[model samples]
Target chain A: MKWKEKDAAMYLAEKEYVDTAVIPLMPVTAGKDMQDVVKSGEFIRYFTEYLERQYAGRVYLFPAFTYIKTKQVPEEQLKHWQELLREEGFNHFLFITSDASWRRTSADSFGELFWIPAFSVENMEVQELAKTMEQQVQQLVPLMMDMWQSEEK
Target chain B: MSEKNHRVSRRQFLTYTLTGVGGFMAAGMLAPMVRMALDPALEASGGAEFVSVGLSEDDLSEEPQRVDFNVEIVDGWYTSEQSRSAWVFLYEGEILALSPTCTHLGCTVNFGTNEEYPDQFFCPCHFGRFERDGTNIPGTPPTRPLDVYDVEVRDGMIYLGQINQRG
Candidate 1:
């Protein structure tokens, strides 16, 4: 399920089924050369959507948490968001992003942080973009499964 | 003389009025029955339309191969194409096409992924495993067997239809 209105309504009625929440930690840079940051945001959206489609009933794909990369990392804001979702019965929180800087600042306070190196998606062909997305999905699946199994234990 | 000729008989007027009202009442009573009789003809048939997954008989072996195809969905006013996948293999001279979606949590299952179970379908989401025939292993998260799709072989191509839950 997604964070949209229709899916949220269904999630409320069947809250017991959805235990995992996926949040995309998107970095939005202001002023100087914002092109790469925007591209990373696009990639994160595509990857998260693929994850949601694979595990629709069990995972809730939340809206992206946009934070300024050039400025201070909004750790407190993310912690607050995590607490809110936890109260709403989300046990597993997976934060996916292409921003590497998050690895330095994020303390795993919210949940598991999956950071992949950002790449230039500009001027890429459709087939090439799909191939790259497939590769990323293949890599992330094992990591996601490990987290889920550890939580069960 | 003009008044007498112009005046209609009471019997004739009553017969005409009764026929008109009774015919309308009879037609109203039969309308719903007629609609019910024609309803099945208007609806799409129960037989599902098969879609080619680009897999041939020669490609199928003892091992399952993942085949993806697009299925057109018409939901009211919105029409869109959605990609669906299945695991196809040949067993005992018969073709079996199983849905890849896990029965436990709807995650896509991989074939021969787990080292412990070399020939079973493994779901990474909850560690669910299915036997070679798509039956859920005992003590696994999945309660039922993986769904199987209706398969048809036309000419030299393999076609798949709606997925049916195991009985």
Candidate 2:
């Protein structure tokens, strides 16, 4: 479910079924790397949107957690969000990002971090971009399934 | 005296012809604009069209296989291509296609994914289970059976249409 008003109401009603929260971690930086930062953010946004549609039944897609790369510490800020989501009863926390630095954060009790290399989709055709993202998301599906399978034991 | 009244004066003739031409011009400009405004409502409310799922009918077996396909959905003025999946297999010597969406909470169900429910569709989100024929097993979360898709085969390829809800 998305963070829309209608989906929010639906989430409240079916809170038990939707136990997973997927958050996108986006880095905002301004400098010589502004273009690259924007590109990566765009890629992550598209990737998460596609991912949400596939697993919308059981996952709540939260808005992107944006933090300035140079001005703030992501770990502290991200923990605050995770704590609030945990309080809301999310069983699994999946953080998806193109920022590799997130891997340094120590794993939380219930949260899992996925750091994928940012694919710069600067000049691709629409059809090609969709096909590429679909294939990439397919590879992540198994990893997510494993996450759920591990919890069963 | 009667002929003089019947003959049209130049001023009267110009007034009549100009009014007639002006009405035609106004209608000509308004017709397309009106049609454009009503284009959405005027469109045919057709049934769901069959989309090729890129699967061969010959490959289907008794074991249900997940086939991912794309559908073009138009909502209001926005049109998008969405990826959807269905379980396709041979049932009773005929091709059968079933939607994998769990009826209870809309989770995607997998075929034979759970060890306990081998040969049945299993919902990972909650423990919803459906038999091989898409029947929702009693005591499962899903209240209704899995939806069946209208299947079409042409030139050895399989195409699936809109889902038909089952009681």
Candidate 3:
């Protein structure tokens, strides 16, 4: 399920079944020269959508949390989001993005942050683009499995 | 000329006009209900929709192979293409295509992923597991068996229909 009206209605009806929340942490730069930053946003969207489809009924794909790239990581805001989602009955939270700066931020305050290396998708062929996305999904699948298993214990 | 030939009584004219107008109004009100009652008959039967899985007869093995395909899904007025994945295999000379979605909470299951249970389907979520034939292991979270897709072989290619729940 996604953060759209239709999916949210269904999620509310079956809130017990959907236990995981996947949020895309996107960084937006306010300059025209930051094409790579913009591309990273597109890549994150594509990647999160794949995750949502793979685990459609169990996972809720929340809207992207966009922040200014030049500023420090929003640790306070992220902690608030974690508390809010936990109150809403989401037992698992997976934050995915291609922004490398998040690695410096402490993961103790928020959910597991998966910081994938950014890549430029401009001028890439369709087949190559798909292969790149597939590789990222493969990497994330085992991590997700581990998270679910830990929760079961 | 007879005066009665061209003359209509007021009562007669009123009755004729009212009947015609009432019939039209009644038909208009009943049209939607009539169509709704017959809608199922007008809809194409579930068997008619067979999506190609792009796998041939030769591709099947004793082991389950993951196959992905896209199908056109219609929900009310919205139409979209959704990619679906299934685990396909040949068992006892019959082509079997099982939906990877675990019967317990709808998580995608993996074939032979558990080291302890090498031949069974394992769900990463909640540690749910199913037997080789998609039956939920006893005392597991899933009370029902994993769904199997209706299969058809045409011109050496395999096409899958709707996912059917097992008894």
What lDDT tens digits, residue by residue, belong to model 2 across residues B25-136? Answer: 9999999999999998988664689999888877889999988777888977999877778999999999989998888877778899899879899987777999999999
Docking class of 3: acceptable
lDDT digits (tens) for residues A1-153 of candidate 2: 898898899999988878789999888889899998899999988888877766777889999998887633468778788889889888788888888777766644448888888878888655567677878788788878887778779
Model 1 alpha-carbon drift over 4 Å, by segment: A4-18, A28-38, A68-70, A107-109, A118-131, B1-48, B74-78
List TM-score (chain A only) for every prediction: 0.88, 0.91, 0.90
CAPRI band for model 2: acceptable
Please give the clash total of every predicted structure, in order: 0, 0, 0
Worst lDDT 10-window in candidate 1 chain B? B1-10
Query: Lowest lDDT 10-mer window, candidate 2 chain B?
Result: B1-10
Residues B76-114, model 1: lDDT tens digits: 799866667899998778999999988876778889989
- iRMSD (Å), candidate 3: 3.7
> After superposition, which runs of candidate 2 have C-alpha atoms over 4 Å from their true positions?
A106-110, A121-153, B1-46
Query: Candidate 3: where is the Cα deviation over 4 Å?
Result: A4-19, A29-35, A56-58, A88-91, A120-132, A149-153, B1-43, B75-79
Best model number under lDDT? 2
